[model samples]
Target: MRDLVAAFGGELPGCDTPGLLGWLDAFSDEHWNFRGRLGGAERDRVRVELPPRLAAAGLAAAAALGLAGSGEPAHREYTHLLILGGLARSCLQRADHAARLAGALRVGGIAALGSLRPLSAEERALPGLGRCRTEADALAAGVRAAFGGRAVPVLVAPPGDPAAHRANTADTYEFWAAGAHPGPGDRILVVTSPIYVPFQHCDAIRILGLRYRCGIDTVGFDPRLAHPPQPGGAAAADRCLQEIRSAIRAARALLAAVG
Candidate 1:
């Protein structure tokens, strides 16, 4: 809590900052584990805040996953990184990290990618991306270039209306899921920004469990989680709360076609 306060400041709106500090100091693991522990909704409810929300979402996901990694692979694991993308400016970073993860993990399709948020005219004019009319195109080009257009094929999801983006996300997810052919016991990892982990995890678990009867693992790449700035990590992940909320809402739609 002190770290959070220090990272930001002692002043937080609607929060009894000092009192919250004391509350944190007094809170324990017992209280943490209590599922009934809840709080009332606050007033004002302005949604302009993004960074802290992302951070909070990441913390929620980490708690959901518990404190554990499968450890470095002894030989190879089915574990793969599913990257949710955002803008074109982030393509290079996300691509590089995906490559690094592929080098380390026995992933099937190398990487599955998506990001439809368009880049500004100025960003499009940048070298190597001048031809891309939208951010997803730039990301696909950047990711392919990261591997020198080698065997690493990046499945870039098509960008469009809210319904289209949701459909595209599910399509790309199914592509990777089928390509990997995960069985009942196999584990798949959903990789993206920390803020995205909860919603994406919800999508993956609900969809896969319904379709394949398989449990999966999810990880978020955040500055707090990854120090080296990797794809699916904060440096590469997009801060798209709108997209996040949409993804969550669509989790039901994703499974509606199924049983």
Candidate 2:
């Protein structure tokens, strides 16, 4: 925790993991969590824009926190490889990464998980994805592209009430488990974007590992290897900051669940 704070050149006197997580969560809430109080235009107006030096600092902090990795799984075999979904491009990228892993690792099965979240205009317009109307559709397309003749299940969670809330990481995990019924002896590997590793890994641990007693390992897809590639810049710093907040919230929830 101290190392992470120091990476951003910040000091927090004597704080443990939860303490530091809470501090960071509050900081992000103040600066970045602009959902409830700010409308779209107002949120855009109030969004924090990092300069080059601060952007570099954010990147450093993210790397220190394990949010910049595209690491390999610890084992060569698993009961299943679970690919978590995101935006149209992210669904594609993560699925493609999972396909590559399948060739090297012995897995009982592979599944791509997504929410029923509808695609945005920009997502629909991304090259080769015009037909996708929902997140699951893009995931299916990606799995098909990457794992040619292989049969991979593409699972979608239903939308939450007040549709804006959307189905999230936990929801997808729950949906997949209810159908797959993986046993306690099973080991599941998860694939997601590098920036989301910490938060999503926490969710998988809390939901799948704790409940089913199944082992959970999550890794991020290397953007350098992603098809179409992920963009980087000052915006990357903002994303890292946003996901740091996500990791904090997820950790808090996991603690509460365990307790």
Candidate 3:
């Protein structure tokens, strides 16, 4: 896989520091302003602000690498690499989003998804977080139906693991079975968590590449300071960031090959 360390901003030693948020902030400053107003009473309305911010970040990063869309170049051509974060499982469970993404992709483009599976029935039976089960199941089923017979390449994490907890492995498998290959033309890369214990979705991509005979890549970054973190001292956040960077590099290489 091709490496794009510069695309991710700068490389730092050790994954301890919160780098993802730093990258996001740097990207936002160099690209566009990400503003959020707290006047809304509807929680959904407030929540809707996240996707745009993320899209902006992704777009900005692409731009920094000279991979973003632009009209100034007159006849500039570039492949669209769709990267979907593994949160809000609903986005993946519903086929509309996936179909829309597919439609937007050019013949030699790549659609990369980062997702997790729905909570199990047993997990859902618990209070508080239990409500998430229905949403997860619905999304999972929707995703399966959306690409049921399509020829989209997919990479996915295994079920019941932390990495696969919110990812749709079944959907990835279905797409792969439909003949999604990473070639000079359009393709899909469904990165999943590895089969090892304490699995993370990041591991899935590496494993899927080997299992399916597809070229693979990996990277990591820390996301804790940007979100919430666990109590006490643990290097989990650093490890995650390191893995993310590895994945990013791999993706860049794949893009270079296809471009």
Top lDDT prediction, candidate number:
2
Model 1 worst lDDT run, 10 consecutive residues: 38-47
Output the number of the TM-score-best candidate. Answer: 2
The better-scoring model by TM-score among 1 and 2 is 2
Q: What overall lDDT goes with each candidate model?
A: 0.49, 0.81, 0.34
* RMSD of each predicted structure: 10.9, 3.1, 14.0
- Model 2, global lDDT: 0.81
- Where is the poorest 10-residue window by lDDT in model 2? 36-45
Off by over 4 Å in 2: 1-20, 34-48, 160-164, 233-235
How close is every model to the real structure, measured as TM-score?
0.53, 0.88, 0.29
For model 1, what is the C-alpha lDDT against the true structure? 0.49
* Superposition error at 248 for model 2 (Å): 0.7
Q: Candidate 2, residues 1-259: lDDT per residue as tens digits?
A: 4554565566765677678667777766765464423553211123556778766777787898899868989999999999998888888889889988999999988999997777888789888789989888999999999999998989878754455556789988999999999878999999998888999999999999999999999999887788768754412776777777788899988987897
Q: Give the lDDT of residue 243 in candidate 1.
A: 30
**Residue-level lDDT tens digits of model 1 in 1-259:** 3333333333333455454433433332122212123231111111233366445643443444322121232335654556655545445555655566667777764564665555678568666888887656776776676667456555655433555433344556665666667668666665554444555666777666567877666654434334233334322112232333334344444444353
Off by over 4 Å in 3: 1-85, 89-94, 104-136, 141-205, 215-259
Q: How far is candidate 3 from the true structure (C-alpha RMSD, Å)?
A: 14.0
lDDT, model 3: 0.34
